[model samples]
Target chain A: MEDNQKKYTELANRIYDLDGAVYECVGSSLGRTFTGGRERTVRTLSMLMYTKPDGHLLRSELALISNMARTIKNKEEKSRMMTEYNEILMEIEKLPDVFGKVDILDDERVRLNLAAKREKLSENDHLVICISRTQGSAGNDIGFELADNLKINYYDVEIFDQVMKRLEADKDAVNDAENFVDFNKYTKKSGGSLKTRFREFNRYHGLPKQDAVFFNMSDLICNLAKTEDCIIMGRCADMILKNNHIPHISLFISAPFSVRVEHIMAVRNMNLKQAVRFLKKMDRQHRKYYQFYTGEKWGKPENYDLCINSANYGIKETIDVIRRMIGK
Target chain B: MEDNQKKYTELANRIYDLDGAVYECVGSSLGRTFTGGRERTVRTLSMLMYTKPDGHLLRSELALISNMARTIKNKEEKSRMMTEYNEILMEIEKLPDVFGKVDILDDERVRLNLAAKREKLSENDHLVICISRTQGSAGNDIGFELADNLKINYYDVEIFDQVMKRLEADKDAVNDAENFVDFNKYTKKSGGSLKTRFREFNRYHGLPKQDAVFFNMSDLICNLAKTEDCIIMGRCADMILKNNHIPHISLFISAPFSVRVEHIMAVRNMNLKQAVRFLKKMDRQHRKYYQFYTGEKWGKPENYDLCINSANYGIKETIDVIRRMIGK
Candidate 1:
């Protein structure tokens, strides 16, 4: 039911249009020249200046602001923006930054680098490919096709040893997160030890590990985001590729169940139907993995740069379509 | 990849065809046939006479007898036929001899008194039905459709529990016959065991239970071949259904793997292409399972009464064609 990549590109263009609107909002807010903190002086006179196509703050949204601020070409204005954020913190009734030690400017700069890495701005960022497969579906074949075309690395996810290593590192975190009773009661981002562990586990174990040879692949991905673009297969890559400016494209490829069944029978040598039932389970696992980590619902248009149906477009055409869109 | 019921009928009609072709051989054999060890003599002779289309014993083979017999139609001249089996031994042999010396004819005559069962038969010694399926080709749907059309019992094979009990009781015999070795070989067929105990733990823990349910379902379907004229879905039904004179019309329904994929995707709500891989594994399991149980290669035209490609013949027309064939 997803629109093709051509449609997806049109949608992406609209999203970029929204970005222009957001920039305009910021301009309108700054034009007011209201910049103090006392009496809860606004960071921007009105958020109405920025039209959030989707309203509500995102998880870890200060990162987005930092990314946007980093793109500001003027060095003085970038530093000034950070100072303005610090001033907003002081104006809020909550508390005063007595020492001015938060260093919001440096934090934004760090976020800028992360966005750069996520976008693969330089040459060294290797593609991180993720894949979600059904029992009878020729997932490996498709992943191979895309990787061959893209000339990037590829891997199947069944190697449990590497997955476990990723799992072990985060076990304590996930257990802690689950065990944590009070989430949101502290400002230090405490609790969610289990969630953290699981997320890390999914990032590695859930991922095909060839790209994971890098230590701390997630961080590396964030770092790599600034270095170069990635062509990741399913494994929640859209979620991993979260930055608006990361220059990475997200894709979800699928075919009709019957077509999958026939292909399984012919190419994969499956029985008449074992794959049909399996597809349901895999779909659940895939969507949960994506939604759980990325906090972006899987298969949603907003989550992917392109969601393709190979049934409609055929495999080769689907990949080509994706290439064209990613190029854009 | 297969022809229709005409091939089966052609194979059946061959008995008549060869009956005429071998007239000279029959006359010569009968003329010189010796009285001593006549049962052995006839047994040896009959093996050389009737060769089915693909050179295996016919599924319709009731007795391993030559197209030409040594008997004369006239009772007075029948004394000459005494060179072969005695009448008493012949009568006993022709009856169900597997159990040894039971009043087989009288037993059948007695069972005929069961009104609910025998009432439907019109001078018919036996009733048989055949339904064939392809990998992910909606054979279950077709099986159910045929049953509904005929107003007969339709078994989905998945929910039937008695199959497991039969498998348990019948496991040793099956193992002996085919060198069968299931990986989960030791789980108790009759009752509770460690595996079952662990399963109970899962129920207590509220784990979704479909996995266990399906495994047991396949076990139940293993023994469903005892009844005649029933449509069974992919659980070694074709293998178990083998019997001579029962007209067990083996059919293989095929469709392009892509078509099967679509049917599954639309019916099951799968994403575009995810089901392709899974359909492959399931088909292999069914084929292996069939070969393991019956020692007959699955999907061989010789193994089937009729094999139709559903893609070539649409579902409705396919069903109609099968029905017409059965009506004859």
Candidate 2:
């Protein structure tokens, strides 16, 4: 990371004005901003275009800035940093520029054919989207809305219910106060069933039972990957779909504490104290669920293909940005 | 949480249009705004007043808006929320007329307070900060120039060094990589020195080495804190100084993956790959250390007094906002 920073800082120092350029980069991102500025002005413009609604930046942009902002002395090293930064952008603009070095993908089963993935892409191309979010992070609003906008089969939690029904039919999975525990604990005699094992795992982790009423929101989100294109929320699908890269886009949405509190307060009309209680509870539960399932902390930013401040760039714009990224 | 939300929503609906005749009941919260405008316009204006940044309202015009904003059915609840939003601010704000019974602290703790800790403030203040970032998130840059305007001290850290030193001072007391075989192992050791136990706990979780340097950076930061106010990049000082809630305001700065990546690329001059790598590596270390010490997800908005989107707010304003938040 330090080495990375050195590269960026050196580049940052070279650019006298950042306000113009940053905006131009952003303009390119959204398309058709008022242009007619030199590179110097465009450079500084980027600094002025200084906001993302939910906080977090795109991976490609991060590379450019990190290299640009680095602290460096040796001109050779500085040039090398610039080269590396450029290579990354050019690679992301289409891929194959990086050759076949697949990074950020951990799944051993994934077959990499970057070109194939690219060729298959279309405005209507299907995708497996994993949205891992904080509890009460308004992920449902974004996820469901995204599916609605995409005009594909939308599934917030209904998908999990369907899966659970199939999984439980084989076994006498009953729902009770300890529904999750019982379901997770028991299965058919022949290794029970996947649902039973999952139920047992859920029981182990104290997850809600996979009843018609008790759903696995996370699993529902991940199953979208197996299907064609779908938007799933808060289930670490990015990591799950790691092997099948390309069409996969991950997003982490968050907002400032005050803004979130205000939204909760206004929407729910909860007094401040109650709002705090609810927000904390949801955040904690989501964190636990994330940790339990992924063995990794949620909202860590690094875990996702994208981390968006739902409050900043917002849900609709975020979707638009992703659409643009996929060049759809 | 839902229940609380329902209650708040119900009350907010009622207060949505308080009549001008009910001025006495509403108190000074809606003074002039209620006097002349149509009730609908007044309500819309009231909502806008709260939502928009206080610039077009103007300094002189703010008095009326402030009055209208202050009008509330539940002063106690509002005060409590206000404190939570800006603990230091409530400590010093002109308490609302119905501040009593709100559990608002009169005898507030007087430890080191930050300029950023102040509430309802928007003045520019110079700040020095330290940061502990995740591997794939460009969190270090916020710390990079946070001290650009500060007069006193600054220490930026990728790894927490002070805690490492504490671990090193007592190697037997601390676990040194070899002790644990599983990733889930965590210390719940009690009846020992808090410092020693924390080290033992971090060891089981595969946290960075005790002498990784972030902990020492924290020590240096805290030492800096002992004298003047600074924006701490990271280090579980909020947890470490749990008792001393006043003076120092701990801020967890983050952005979504894509945003941060973009930020790293532009700011650090890194290629996409290196930026992603840098963000992930540094962020993971920080999260591990943070969760290990704090027993809370590091970047949860609630854990920190202020959680800002460096991408949303931009680095300079984030620093400015922090300065204002801490009331530096």
Candidate 3:
């Protein structure tokens, strides 16, 4: 019994170590900072291992660890590990569950449910254009020109201002959202108890401020769609509008990596490497944000009515093409 | 010494097993067939282990093995293997070389050298357009119309016919290329000595018929560019022309995955799932072929002067956008 306890503890320690490595790898790959949530999750799983926690929860956590292992750079070792991993899974499956059940906490479900409850507008009743673009793709320039060409209101940063105004009624929420952004940007190492760290991680990952901002922004977008014909840039407006069954033409503007890199270099006065790095970071952020909010793949053509490589048609012609697309 | 030999053999066997797994994974992932060259490579490395082979050669071979390991789906296993993999690298680096030096064989080098030797037409001396596209993106229709609008010769499968005619002079080469394609399409298993198997793998992976066809098609593309303004579709004409330093406008056409699937469904009468699968296979083939030949990422904006989601502008507007970009 003592030997078995030691063996399980060793397994838990290995899981903890692997989870950290994966968290760091995924964070660096996405150009984001690693936070405390993953570690907390790992600790929870580690503790629950003794009690024979829910198999599904255990499998899901282990699956994440496995994903990181696949990134291993050596073949012979990888295969050996894979074989061992298969054995571990078999062992896990055989372990009888005797403890209290642990339910998976999915905050995204709440957001999705809220989205599903939105009042959908008739297809032709609203004219909204949502432009999602990669950085330096001239998406903003094109979106502005498109709105001008069609004589419609254009919402970009103004949407943020509107959301902030709405959040002003709850000053603490606004302050928390602002602080969260600041924390994400500047906080490298966080200090707290494991429980507090886990809560902080959940607050950032699952949302409190970010979620509040997103939900409020979503409401503003739907309201605008009902009130007037307009063009909304970023903010996952395309998805928010879609959630409401509002008639909107979604456009994804992208240019080749090199072209966009060049554009960034020219506009931002950054060198090639810096521009590339900046673009990758921005692209990742947009993708993550979109995926997080909408549960849809961003920049995928089926999601959008029209997708354009804006570099193919210069800014003016890109606008012209959109105008023609809308038959204006 | 006997123990060392046994240990090396064990390492070799592990490499062989892992290499087979990787080859199968990559082939299935790309929807291609696994050829024999990889096994031969593994055997050579195994044999060389006793003699102390070139560190670079051994490393490169191991690198391929390592790449396969990255595909392992289990995280704990992946991490464990990766750690062991790093240790193996340290061990390999510590080994003393004591045998004849082996040089890496790269057939792509010869192709690249041949490309370098081609005569470059001055910019503005040639007005050539190359269009590369995803399956079911209406790239062909756009290319045909763009050619008609420009009053230029449009080459599509005609390039294949022309290449076939060129290869006819070398009937055996033509027969080999044709037979190779048939073999790739139909042959499930091959039985041969390791040497012959390796050679067959090299022939397919590196080139003989496919390479010959590619080179001839390249020559034709360059020659045509030098003589007249024309639009070339597929056939890596863009890269071929670029390699020759011939002036040309390259365009990549794409539509959203769902949109393309619908297009294929309507055009080919395939159901949604079938169309999706078909599109994915075709896209993978084109990507593999393009990468194999050009050594550049396919559908990257930097490679092409313009890329359009044809679904955005439709056939006519898409053509118009291209025509306007060229100041037609």
Candidate 4:
């Protein structure tokens, strides 16, 4: 265990150094826009390192970091660093699972806390708005302002932290849920044919670890929607609530690809090329993430109730349009 | 020549018969939505037959008609029709081009008409708005209203007629223009590098017959923009004006796929499934057409100055937003 901990610590520290070096090299030349790439990877890896240190995530991160490192001008040094990271990855694959089985249902404390919170909430007549948006479409800004106008709690990254906490406390919960299929419950809720219900069950069972996080995150979103009138941004919340038969106004905010690239360039002080690359990468990630869990095309108009082009109306008018939509 | 005329007339009549029968069968059952399908195909084929009996277009139309006919309930009848069409297609492939070459440059009448029209117009400080929209987004309605409010000429299908008239008068004009590659003229106009200019020249040279029609349509749009203020709908007019350095505001109108589907169902009296299928088909066609002509992604925000989700703000509010955008 001590040896594993040392190996993990050394790998984490190296990732930190490489991240800083890449940032210092590229960020200085390209301004601040390039910081999000390697820097974000390191940040995410660090969070995982501190929490779970899942082998699959670490391997993927190492691969990404090595790819980014190859872009550096010093080819010889980067190649050497990549070789070292590959060796570390191989070693990580051999390491035994550090986390033991967690009995989620037997945890009285978590259940009690959830029950107490549920008891205090009104749980009825609560308005929920799920806004899915493209990168740099000012979706977050619109969501925040809309939340303010309606005097409601806005959940964005906060929901991620909540899900993460739950996951840390009950690592086996998701695995158990995947193993346990409630066909009757699903069929009753979906009103789908037995074949479709079976397909849905298989989809739930086959979810990857990362996508399972989305599953848990979706549960948290459903809970939050029930507790209060709040605005949820991204995370396939719209589909989640709809599947749960919750009444909510779902909005998809997008702008032209060029408009989004320009918006990112302006906000992040990125050059045009950098902005375009960043937006493309982020858009692909968002699309894949949304599609993996929902089994629907991302940004397709039919999925959402209202689709708004933020560039058409800007921030203020966009909010006004939504306000009018919900009659708030 | 008389033999070719008889063959073309016979083929056209067969297409009309097949189209009517298909419509009479499908339209009666599916309501009005499916009427636009094979019926529109027949109408386009009839127009082409009357104006320019281009063998390439005739072959494609036969292929389309035969494919549509295959969908008919009477498989044996449809297969017989398909076999007959295939034989006609073979005959079309062998027919010599009957149309005489037209001298586009020495046409004094056309030049004089265009010159007279140009003279009648203000020719300066006119607002030209080009709108590109997805199907069922009420883009045509918005363009008409915007034109009405601004009191500008709205050109939609009218532009197609104008282009067709010019093409019929001078069949060789497009071919001549494609062959006459003035490198200096292109370089000076584009201010692109020699390599890019050579590539652009190749793109122009390699345009298919159908896309070459777009090239002529673009020329007409440019001429109209210079002569007077007008709102041009579709036909990649936005890129056309931008290429000519003609100042114009381009807008792309779209709605959520579901919203647009519902709109079509309501207006066309189509069922839910039929509306969804129609919108998807139209969207794919528009995207392909736009990309072929302009080499730009259709309905991309950056391509247009504004992209309005008309569902957010119905027809009236959408027009009002555009009015505000242009400060009209």
Highest-scoring model, TM-score:
3
Q: Which digits, one per residue and each the tens of the lDDT, describe model 3 over residues A1-328? A: 6765665566655666554554454442421111346556445655556543233335434543443445556666555544655565555444444111211111232222211112433444556788888877777767755664564666764334433554466434444234323333224442446687567557555665556566767787888778777778888887787677665666778876767777766555579999899898888767777787778876655455446666555666567656654545
- Model 4 deviation from the true structure expressed as Cα RMSD, one decimal place: 30.0
Tally clashing residue pairs in candidate 3: 6
TM-score of 1: 0.26
Stretches of candidate 4 exceeding 4 Å from the true structure:
A1-129, A145-152, A159-216, A219-230, A244-250, A254-280, A301-328, B1-129, B136-138, B141-153, B159-216, B219-231, B244-249, B254-284, B301-328
- Specify the highest-DockQ model's number: 3
| DockQ leaderboard ranking | 3, 2, 4, 1
Q: Using alpha carbons, what is the TM-score of model 4?
A: 0.42
- Ranking, lDDT, top scorer first: 3, 4, 2, 1
Tens-place lDDT per residue, model 3, B1-328, is 7866666666665555555655454442421112346556446655666553232234434543443455556766555544555565555444444211211112232222211112443444656788888878778767765765664666665334434554466434443223322333223542446787567557655664556656766776788788867777787887787678666667778776766776676655578999888888778767777787888877765455455666554666667656655556
Candidate 3 local Cα displacement, residue B231, angstroms: 3.4
Q: What is the interface root-mean-square deviation of candidate 1?
A: 29.4
Predicted candidate 1 versus true structure: per-residue lDDT over B1-328, tens digit per residue: 1342333333334443333333333453422222234444344324322221111122112111221232234554333323232332233233321111111111221232111122345544334344445555656556555654554444533223322323445332222112212312234532357697576547534432333443344444333333433455455444443422222344466554666676655444466566686567556655665665566766543344344544433455446556644442
What is the Å distance of residue B250 in model 1 from its true position? 1.8
Across A1-328, the per-residue lDDT of candidate 4 in tens digits comes to: 6776666566666666665665454443322212356556455654454454232234334433443444557777666655665565555445554111111111221122221122233446477788888877778767765765675666665334433444455544344222222212223542557686466556557753345556677778888777777778887887887778665667778876766776666555578999999888778767766776688878765455456666655676667656654445
> Quality of candidate 3's docking, in CAPRI categories?
incorrect
| True C-alpha contacts between chains kept, each model in order | 0.00, 0.01, 0.07, 0.03
In the range B1-328, model 2's lDDT, one tens digit per residue, is: 4653444343323333332323444454313333344645544433433332321221112222222333446777445432332332232122221111011111222122232223422243223343444433334444534543443333423112222324355534333222211122254431357786577568645444443333444455456555544445445655655443324545555655776676556555588999888777656656666676557777654344334444434444445544443334
